[model samples]
Target: MAEKIYAGVKVQVDQEGYLIDTNQWTKEIAKEIAKEEGFELTETHFAIIKFIREKVAKGEALTLRSIGKSGATDIKGFYQLFPGAPLKKATKCAGVPKPSSCI
Candidate 1:
């Protein structure tokens, strides 16, 4: 793990950049992470991020189809939101570990 600053807060992250502690997450941190990943955050992105965080906190497995069914956005919209890899990008921005289904 390595220490990184996001929105003026220092936190630990794994090699892949996911936060080592979810308690360290904040919307500002999410924005910084998103910017690093090549996109800007939006209300829609936050909505989806919130959903993903909640799911993970509750121990529910996340999948592209699960996110698509979230009512936040459909699959096409998810792809458009995160670009290259939706699940990976979304989980990273949400400050959660990369889902097992990712690779």
Candidate 2:
């Protein structure tokens, strides 16, 4: 793990760039991470990010189907939002660990 700065905040992250501590996440941090991932955050993206964060905090398993059913967006829309490697990208930007489901 390594420490990185985002939105002027320093935080620890894994080799793949997922946050090592979700408690360090903030909207600004999320925006910076999303920007680094080549996209911008919208209310739609925030809705999904919020959903992901909540689920992770509750120790629930996260999956594409769960996210698609989140009413934030469907699977196709989720793909469109994050583009390549949607789940991995979304989890990364949401400041959560990369889901075990991802390779």
Candidate 3:
């Protein structure tokens, strides 16, 4: 049988950033993202991820073409701030709600 991975079960790094084993993410990632966004981890961040998750559930692609300004390029700037963040993963963690096509 294949190993099972949760929808949001990826690891989160400190300010240095972390790798995304799978497309999914984790709450720790969310908290790290909040710190990068200049905000403390809170319910709002969770809400944002839920909203993104809902969009993904609705068949929307997580691509820049679909999400607008949040295109892959957007993460380049964020990467600079965070240093080693997996751009797309970090975006997802940050509650940016990536379109299905972003990756």
Candidate 4:
């Protein structure tokens, strides 16, 4: 694990840079992560982030197809919101472990 400080909080990250401890996540941290990825969290982005976090907390599997059906956003819309690797980037912004389906 590697450590990163965001919004004055230290977080443990995995080899792929996803947060290891979801509890350390905060909205400020999410904003910082999104900014570093050249993205700004709009309402749509926040909805997706919230949806991903909820699903992760439930120990559910995440996938592009599932996210599309999640009603948060359609598959095509998800691509528009998160251009490349929507699930991966969104999960990272949500401060959760990378979904197994991501890689």
TM-score of each: 0.97, 0.96, 0.39, 0.91
- Per-residue alpha-carbon lDDT of candidate 4 for residues 1-103, written as tens digits (9 for 90 to 100): 8999989998889988899989989999999988888788888888888889998899988888888878889998888887788888899999998778953
Q: Which residue runs does candidate 3 get wrong by more than 4 Å?
A: 1-23, 61-91, 94-103
Tell me the deviation in Å of residue 36 in model 4.
Answer: 1.2
After TM-score superposition, what is the CA distance of residue 87 in candidate 2 from its true location, in Å?
A: 0.5
Q: Top TM-score: which candidate number?
A: 1
**Tens digit per residue, CA lDDT, model 3, 4-59:** 22245534343334333324456775665556556554454354445455566666
Whose TM-score is higher: candidate 2's or candidate 4's?
2
RMSD of 3: 8.3
Candidate 1 per-residue lDDT over residues 18-98, each given as its tens digit: 999998999999999999999999999999999999999999999988998999999999999999989999999999999
Per-residue error (Å), model 4, residue 77: 1.3
Which tens-of-lDDT digit does each residue in 19-98 have in candidate 2? 99999999999999999999999999999999999999999999999999999999999999999999999999999998
lDDT of 4 at 60: 85
- lDDT to native, each model: 0.95, 0.93, 0.46, 0.87
Cα deviation of 46 in candidate 3 (Å)?
Answer: 1.0
How many steric overlaps are in each model, in order? 0, 0, 12, 0
lDDT score for candidate 1 against the true structure = 0.95
